[model samples]
Target: MEYNIDLQIDKQSLIETKSFLIKIGNKESNWLGDVSIHHQATDKFRLLEAVLLDHRLNVVRKIKAKDVYTKNADSRSTFFDDHLEDKFSLRHNQFPYYIKYSYRIIKRDFLFLAYWIPQYYSNVSTISSSLSLTRPMDYEIHLDSIGEFTYSSTRAAGLITEKWSIKQPKKIGKADFSPPATESLQQISIVPSDINYGVKGSHASWEDFGEWVANLNSGLDLLPEEEIATLKKKFGHIEDQDTLIKKLYHHLQDNTRYINVSLDIGGMKPHPAEYVLINKYGDCKALTIYMKALLNAFGIPSFYTLVESGSNPKSIRENFPSQQFDHVILCVPTKSDTIWLENTVSYLPYNYLGSFTQNRKALLVNKGGSQLVKTPALTHTDVHQTNTYHLTFEGDRLTGTLYSKLKGEDYEKIAYVETNLSSQEKKKYCHKYFNNQGFELIDLTIHQNSRSLPEVELTAQIDLPKHLRQVGPLRIISLPASTMPASEVFKDRTRPVRLMMPIDAHDKVIIDSSQNWTWKLPENFSLISEFGTYQITYELVNNSPVINRRISLGSRDIPIENTAELYTFLLEIETYESSAPIIPTH
Candidate 1:
């Protein structure tokens, strides 16, 4: 894959300047020519022309506007300045076809425009790519990359253009389990080095970057005088700062809904406090800004911060600071605690960063500049999940009530099930979530607790599998077969391992035969490794077979050297679990 960027810079009227990009590739390297171009009203990028030129640089056909599909892209709302997206398709849609296409765009200056290497899920070993830049030498620019990128300049027609190219061997694999920066595949981030947008002074350091953000986001505290006094009146009774924060947070949640409003500079700088207060909705940026404004109303200070947020935690490179964030939140300081609020989730609880932003670095803005701070880490107790089952065996069938509760990072999964699963689909989800090869959910109820912490409760009556064996009186049962939480054995033990999310939880299983039969127990089964511990305990109380299983995983990513130990421990658990069939003696 070859990507070329030709920029005609207009320092005075940046939007008036033109930038053309060309991409050409084929499937021999697993490179399919697919592109999506985005343009907004404030910095409208016009597409002059686009066509597929064969390997010989001959035009096969031009992409017509009619043939192209354009749709409005609202990261949040309709008010976000008429955003447009164009998707182009070439003559065919398979590999082994070589085509080159180019499109011209008019871009706003001083933005972090970039090309991510080895597009998500692309096998670098099967592909080779390069990046070329054609710009005036007068523009001092800095290009950010994790791996080696070549730099060279050529002079032609009194124009000195610099080019940087990165080529990888076919079938090159990437390891991305780092703490501060997740370097999955080397990417390129390009920006003008010594430039300032409005106030973001320079790209030289994180401090300069923060100052620039501070300038663009200046005056975000400007709210209506009447509104400020009224806002103060609302939380004035609460003397304690944390208590006041809880009240104000709940107030914000009840009054506003998340509607994304990202367009042009709106994508970065937020809307004023009054706009969101009147509209009662905003994206992460606008909402964070507005929350800070409300805090200001009560003489509480807060900072608008940027972070790369998602269910799977990601980190920003501490060494190389660039604009790579996708979401924004507010950091409010209290007398003894720092509250991290995710503005987009209107129903978020107080100081609950959820799994998306917890234990990750964020760029907090101040009048002086930017400071890098790590969000509060979620502990084992914080991310807790518990599952319990009460079972009674009658003849050849096993039926019981299953009660489950998930909180913190683990709760995200069950919450998804609650929202996405229909009444009819609940059984299927039960089977999947419980890892039961076969199970029937008699009835299921899901509860989403959104006030204090992110919690989900699932209560159901389930008929479990492996209940009847050989259709005989002396039957065997293995309790908590799939209740243990662990990853299916990882095959790539040689690769570096990084825990994407921490794993820690407890589970219990209780089986009763209605006092009809006595039970047999296996030798104590327990496996302790560096990863954590898994234990299964059993005892008989008045002809009732009581079973308890608990597993707590310490880290998300295990080191490569210890991957074998982790694998062996998990293998033993699976083996012992599968062999724990006990005989019921009547």
Candidate 2:
């Protein structure tokens, strides 16, 4: 069944106010299924209306009929839940669920222009069938007229049966556009009372913590004296628990290889420490728990810390424990440095935490109990690199040599790539890197130093087509590549753009020319032609020449129905050129 939806929003205030409206609908084949609409609300706000559109018969059902005041007190609303499964027909050719809500401030001065922001699925889902939006709706305040505003939008739709289509809303105006400085508007601090700390497994009492350690030792089948002596030495240093914990953590980190292969049952519980020792590889949880047990054997206090491994974005839940943590490490407090051990990575330098684990809240679980602590940040000195390259041009052929000095994570990335790739595969990879300039590489080579702060140097010889150069008199002459014409590429012929080559990060490129050529031609080549340098930088460099010769042309922006014209425009440009030769008449 086909459907059409129209949504509108309007707001008027004594001063300035921030307001928005959202409309969401879903189409499914079956009539009985769950529909979820979750949103956060606040006091002094209103949820104006929510209507369902029965497109087949063109009827609208008022599912929620309440004034703004009745719904203002609660900060959450569930329009539909499990109870509503039998109440509404959720099958095909039925009413489409639609929701539209707007809010305004009754008190305080609202100083900023309002916007309608849309968040599609974070990851694409294959179950959506259709998704689209007309121009996004937005209201902007003009600089000269502070109180006045402008608004515009059309309709948007998302439809699905078996697959999903996700389209995030486009920004209505310039993101950086803002009103002039105003002292009345203050930055708001939004702090939620509840943060998700993730789920907890079956707990062992504090007294059982030691027993758990003893069981782990026996289960690993470790040598009796080796285990006992190791435990005694670790426990013997009671004067400094922090140092003992750090030592145990370092031991675990040094011995373990961080491979993220999780068995179903092992994901929830730690792997046997003996298995980890034999395999030398385990996921974050396994390694972290193993470290904790080792610390316990030594009588040092340590804990397993669980947190998501990435930029620590704010959590959306109000009071739920965080269940989204993907990585685990260890935290031990010493008298000198509060040591945070990321046992998942074996190559990382001691006392160094990359940005992936920095400044995020993690749950620390130990016999002393679980609590939240923030991981430390990485400094500039921890991971830095310097790159340098030299290029020389012979005719249209270019040869270059590149060198990179890497530290920290940069070195690890290079080492991993080198170990995994074969010599021929590395050459193909270098070809793509040089192909960024639309050139073909003739030969490529890679060299590396296996010592401290590993470095990879790449050298390549490439061919830059001679047609890219320009010659001129009254009309500029250029030879574009067989793939495209200069006019089509430089569609906006009003200005010229500069060209730049991409080098590695922190790298410098020096171009050297072995020979220079200048030409003096006949009377036909002599004319009053103006020439100057052209330079503009967009996302990348666009430096191709322009010719003023007249040629037969086709329409611009061909319509979709004219498939032949579109194909001709795309394929015919390669064959376009002057068919006649230039001749001088006396």
Candidate 3:
């Protein structure tokens, strides 16, 4: 079954109607017809029409007023979508059936609208989805699609425009990896072209938008003298601006939980700081507001930055400037570096921007207006995982003392192991630094500082069978080959491959042979590719062999044609690692 939704918008007011045709294949197939609308305190939805049809397209059941119902969505979460629906059942219906329904929605707030162009119309070989938009009065509109989609636009009337049809729609495949939405579909971002929130501010340009945002919250940005004095008295000794910024961020985190209450202007205007302080809870917008207030009290300046929050990085349409962001964050500028703070988290390290906001573009709203800026890019240097191992072998029983530290996104990973994982789970992770097929954890100890992104460390001692292979008089020692478990295998894949996470890792293994043993070190080996670099070093110092291997990926995106080369590069590195051996003489 497939469907199409037609929507009409006039600023904050909107009307949406959808029609779905379902075919009953067998007795086990579904035949119930349904139409639904989701609404909230400000915006609303109303079901307009619903009908069920038989084989001859004859109307079987017309939705009665009693068929509609509304209820609370879910009890498990505080924030959930609530909706009303008009439903009809055809349990005894024949094989062929048709269903159609329509509903209208009042968005009320036009800060942003996400319209996903329909792609699944499979009854026929191909079906095209279209969109038509008309601006209110003299306002302008903006629309665009990701790279995969091709579209053209035509004017209808008084600044009225219509995207007659969408082109180059690809069928959904069973491939495990998903390309970014921006690259997969055409997105129609329709706004009043003026770029203003229409609440008294001119958002025609970044500077205007920033000034308007600054003026919009001018009163909320202030802290009472008593409140400022109290906050200062509590933190009078913290001199560093960055440290103070972090301290205030911690204060905001400690003082509030996220309570979502969309009212008045809806998701556009943020709650006042005073209200949040008294209520002890606020959403992302409110938290950012309160954090800004705290910083203001301390003579520090920060801007309200809007961002699309997610693990996946999404960019603001550089060419089109409208409401594209779903969340708000606070950006603090300083002397040595600009500090980005996530006021929602109490435990993440200060100034440590993880995947949620890292490497994405954001709208920084300040007094001068708004400016588009990029978040910090997580590199091998910022997000690194290093493991150091000291090993000794005696009678096929290998003992290793391993210490490791995870930084950046790598650290962002284990950062939750301490508080979130059970002791057994933590031990399982600790073993990864030392475990081989034949190894056993003799003793393990772990240390961590998750309150900030300083680092997560693990120390372990393991016993394993001697990996040494004796080739006549020369003893061969092949260091354990490090690996990032294979996440994707696009064997015989025809489509473009989606680039996965960038890897930045280094492993150091120091072997202290029996005091009487000596090693003949091999010359260091290095290989640099367009993707990344791989290197191996074998150094024998005072009868102990020090081995270091580094894998630093240069980019996170790659074309499909390069998959074979990438696979070969990784395979060669694996083979080279296993083949390179230290020759130790006893």
Candidate 4:
């Protein structure tokens, strides 16, 4: 892969050309032979060349650029944007072949010059890769990368050319529980010091970026006079700030819906508050500003906050700040506490962030500019689960009732299931977690409790006829399988391992049989490590075998040096699971 960028300082534009030489090894790598070019409607794009070659380097076919299909990027009405995409696929019956293609994109007044990822996947090794950039000698730019690369620079006439390259890069297979690609892969990003995309902006600092965003969204948060008067009259009797904010937030949720709006400078600038009030629908940016306008009616203050929102969010580079945020929320600070409002979803409990936006740095866009601040973090108490089960055997069938309670992220997950799925679908979903090869759900119920950090309770009754097995003279009782990682998962691991999510969970199981059967007592033990802790206890109460187990995992990224310890800890869990086989003796 060869990536080149030419910075036209005088015109404040960037001309990027990318050429790829990919080999199609199998049916799966056939995706590499496909061509897809994405650009905004306002930008200029040209496909210079595309050809398919056989194993002998002879031209098998020539792909014409005119033959490609071009259409709107998004066909859904909920998503409105000015972007276009051109795409075509290359498929052949030959054993081994090569595909070569090159394209150019011209961007006028660009903020980000290039974000290059040479390696397509962890299984694909790169033979050779290079990135070359030519710009005015005096013009300033920002460049960042993940790992070391061979770099050099040369100056000719009035232009400077810098090159970064990698040779015969080895393939690094991804392991289970590995961190996100952006954190564990090789990448590079380049940005100009100053730029304009309808609204002027600079990449020199976070303040400059925020100032650019502030200008785009300025004077857009106005409400009608009659609406303001109505709001004032309605909230006139309420003196408490928290109650007023809650009322306004609930009003925003009830009156407005979320959509994707990507107009006016690529949707960086939000639509006006009046648009939402009149249309009753808006995107994240629009909804946030609408909520801000509602607060303004009663003289309350809030900031339009930008955040990188996801279950496992991309880490924000504080030192090299750029346009890293993808979602917006409203931040309101009172005397006693600070409130964060995610106005996109109507069903989310008030003042709840869940896992999407919690525990991350957010940029607060204000009139003066922007400032970085930390959002609330989650602890074990916030993301935890507890389940209790009582099992009874009747002839060859096993019947059990499960009582499950969940909080934080778990609550959010179940809440989605409760809202989106039907009763039969919910029962079908419960079968997967019951851990039996075959089972029937007798009853299933879910209850959602609304609070700042809400909780959900799931009650289920299940019948399993395949669990109890008779092996010669021994009768064995099978329980739910543990989710601990197996040894084969960490084999040939090269990258660091990290816990996928923060978890604290406990489970209790009780067995009762009409026949007076004696059981072999399993030893109780506990193992603790930096990654997390595990414990299990077994006892006999009222002639029934009672077992209690717990596992608490901390959210930590374990470096390569510490992975041995993680492997050891997981092996202990596997051994403990195998050692506790429930068997009945007469």
Candidate 5:
């Protein structure tokens, strides 16, 4: 794949002329045959030309990008479609073909000058790529890049011309638990030092960017007189600040839903609190501002926070700050501690950010300008979970009741199951959760301890069809597959290990049989290392064996050299718990 881009910046708009040359190597790379150009609703786009060429480099056909498709049709992720794609499809019969297409986009409201990524997809090699950018001599911009590239610049006719090129890019090997591409990929980011996103703003620094955000959202938190009266009438009597905050947060959740409104500065600027109050729906930004307004009604102060929120969020370029955040949250400071609220999600417990927004730096926008602050980080204990099973073996079958207590991300999973799934869907989910080990789920129940705390309890009664497996002359109890086995997950890892959160889990099992069945107690095992720790114990009580196990791995970015040790630890755990051998007394 090769990309040739020319960017011209002026006071009114930024114009980008982009051309792509993609070679389809096989059936897997056939997706390159289709061309897609993405742009916001505010931008003007035009496709100049598209041509399909054979392996011999002769033009076979010409295509046009006439179809416009909405960017996201999934209602679950996007309530309101905010972007469009200009698509050109070229169907070819032969492999090793080439597709060339070029287009132009005029961006009137943009936060960043350019985000040039030469290699957009994984496992795809780039032959050559180049960028020619021109801007006014007085305009100041900052450039940040990862990986190797060549750069050159010149000044002529009161304009600065900058050229960047990447040739024969090296391959990045896949690895288990690798960091996000933004952290590891070869890319370039260009940020302007000042102005223009429908309104005046600055991208010179984090503080400047945040102050611009504050100014954009200024006076958007004002509530109507009646709304203020209603709020006071509902929660004015609550003297405790925490209780008040919870009440207000709950009110916001109950009253509003999330939608995307990208009309304002291409969704960079949020709609006002009054809009949400009247419409009962808003995007993350609007919902956060609404919550802020609700808190401010009672003289409580909160900062509108911007964060790159996701399971594995893109790395934030803190030094060259631009509009990098995709989600908006609210940060409230109280007497005892600070509270972070994810206003878009009604299912999340109050003040809980979960794994989506936790353990990351966020920009707080306030009257005092912007400040960077770290969100709450979870330790192994924070995500602790326990599973207990009481089992009885009769003939070749096993019946048992399992109870699970989940916290942190585990709690979030079960919470989602409880909130989103139906009775039949939950049953199917439980079967999959148990690794589909031929266990018949007789009964399953999900329980939430409280609405304030993010925790869940699950009780399930299951019957294993054939619990006993005869190996030679002995019977062994077949166990569910390990969640992360070394062979499947940690094998041939080339990248450094990066964990988003720590893991701490415990398991206990009590085995009894109506028939006189005895089992040899396996020797206890324990291992501790820098990667993590593992321990398992066995006890004999009333001719039955009670087993307990615990595993913990701290959250950290470990280098590739240390992953071998971790892989060995995981291998040992996998070998030790493969099956349980049993002896039947006649």
Candidate 6:
């Protein structure tokens, strides 16, 4: 069964007529659906209210009165066509029907009316329609629902209006819905259709759309053949199949800008490719088709591919043919691979496919026919980040320099910050990146190699506070200098212990002392807590003490999943210290 809907709306607050035609087997069912529109009344002014029409042709059921509502008012109304029949049914078990409905509003200011068009099965009883017997019965269905809503308001700006449509289907008893006698219900065909109408306050009309495309196509003929040939010779160089296709693919990506424009005005017929080129901007369809035409001029084979931009994973069934795509792209065929090009961003990479297009199936529409194509897989090797740092300590002050290199989408973020941020802002940014480490930055430098790669290298010299040292007979403290005894720092003994220094990672300390300052031994000193490699190496150089302390305490590789553990580990390492009391040496 197939269904079709047609609607026409005017500038007045009236709907002339909304019609529907449903085709089931050899018979066609027609219905007239319309709504009498109204507007809101206000003091010193009156505005027409936008009207919404909801009607499905395939489903035969009662229309409830309470299903509709009006704004700022308590009452609602329900009206039906007196000349048309109330209900209709189909004779064939596997055919589809069409339903059409529309309405209008007089005031151009209230142009934002919308509709919540329900699916056909929402009103139908599935229990009664269930087929009997285990025999195979093939069935297919198609749905075409369109809404043209318009409104204007003085409080709001100009008139806002739109017309949107969708086509969906329901299939039963088949493996992946492949058309054949492989499973039960092998011989069934169903098609559903619908149409809708509304009004808008604009001088542009459907005829203007057709004229625009036609005139643009005619203008293409005016270009000199020699110039066209020259353009082809310059742009078309396909030495290697993959390289050629990739170049052509990148050509479209670098040339066109994407603007979202719908086809309800001209019923999905695209504008002239030459016009789009002059404008340098167009909708997905216009840009895609333009790329296709350009490739054809250069003896390259290409096609238009349509797809939906969401997470729905159902494949398209050939038994049902209807427009279900929300986006359009270009597909170039080469000896080795078929390249997909999206003509939205002039800066997007030639081979980089966004998450929206990743691993999704698309319909490739060519002169021959439509075929399905799956997007290539994305691998972890395509993404990576590298960081390097140099650290040194001089007289209790630690100085370090850091460099970071990023690839893939991560580069996009750092590149923007690198270009826009000032020197002071960059210091603030570095502080944040280092977990708010209290360090004085001496120098900060950022270098970007390429915009396409979107990679940035940052280098900075930073000074950190000195907190640990030994004095005279005993070590003053192994803990950070910021820590103080509770007796002096806190008046109340019950007060919580507080440390001034922020702890992020474990630290290692090496000390070189002069032999003239003789060290006294702490007889009672003992190790308290330890993790990983916490060792000290002592060597005598010219009778002087050269002490090397190495500590490996934190996880080498931080896991995002264990971020909480990492934080806890940081806190634990910060508080860790040897508390064993030192005994005076004789």
| All candidates: TM-score | 0.86, 0.42, 0.77, 0.91, 0.95, 0.41
Compose the digit string of candidate 4's lDDT tens values, residues 333-363.
9998999899987767778777889888888
Question: What TM-score does model 3 achieve against the real structure?
Answer: 0.77
Between candidates 2 and 6, the one scoring higher on TM-score is: 2
- lDDT for 4 in candidate 5 is 80
Candidate 2 residue-wise lDDT, 120-149, digit = tens: 222222221121212213422221111211
- Candidate 3 vs candidate 6: which has greater TM-score? 3
Best by TM-score: 5
In TM-score terms, candidate 1 sits at 0.86
Backbone collision tally, model 3:
7
Best by lDDT: 5
Tens-digit per-residue lDDT, 1-586, candidate 6 = 2222222223322222222232322233222222222333311122112122223333553334443333332221211111111222223333343332323223222221222231233322121111111111121123222222221222212332222333432333222112221111112221212111222111122232223333323322222366457656876555665665556556666666666543333224455577566777677667767766666666677666677653223334433443435676666766666676766655445655543454566666543244567665433344334444344434344456645564444444455456557877866776675444444667777677753443466666665443334455343323222111212222222212212111122222223332243433222211223222333333444433333333333212222343344334334434443432111122
Q: Using lDDT as the measure, what is the rank order of every candidate, best first?
A: 5, 4, 1, 3, 6, 2
Candidate 5 residues lying further than 4 Å off, grouped into runs, are 65-76, 422-424, 436-440, 465-467, 478-488, 579-586
Supply every candidate's count of residue pairs whose N, Cα or C atoms clash at under 3 angstroms. 9, 17, 7, 0, 0, 30
Give stretches of model 2 more than 4 Å off: 1-266, 292-301, 311-320, 332-339, 345-351, 407-412, 420-505, 516-586
In order, the Cα lDDT scores of the candidates are: 0.68, 0.39, 0.65, 0.78, 0.80, 0.40
In the range 525-556, model 1's lDDT, one tens digit per residue, is 77787777888778877777777777766646
Order of the predicted models by TM-score, top scorer first? 5, 4, 1, 3, 2, 6
lDDT of 3 by residue, 265-343 (tens): 5446777888788888877787889988998887888889988876664556777666668778888889988888887
Residue pairs with clashing backbones, model 3? 12-108, 140-193, 210-369, 210-370, 211-369, 349-452, 349-453
For model 5, what is the C-alpha lDDT against the true structure?
Answer: 0.80
Error of 2 at 103 (Å): 36
Question: Residue 473's C-alpha lDDT in candidate 6?
Answer: 39
Pick by TM-score: 2 or 3, better one: 3
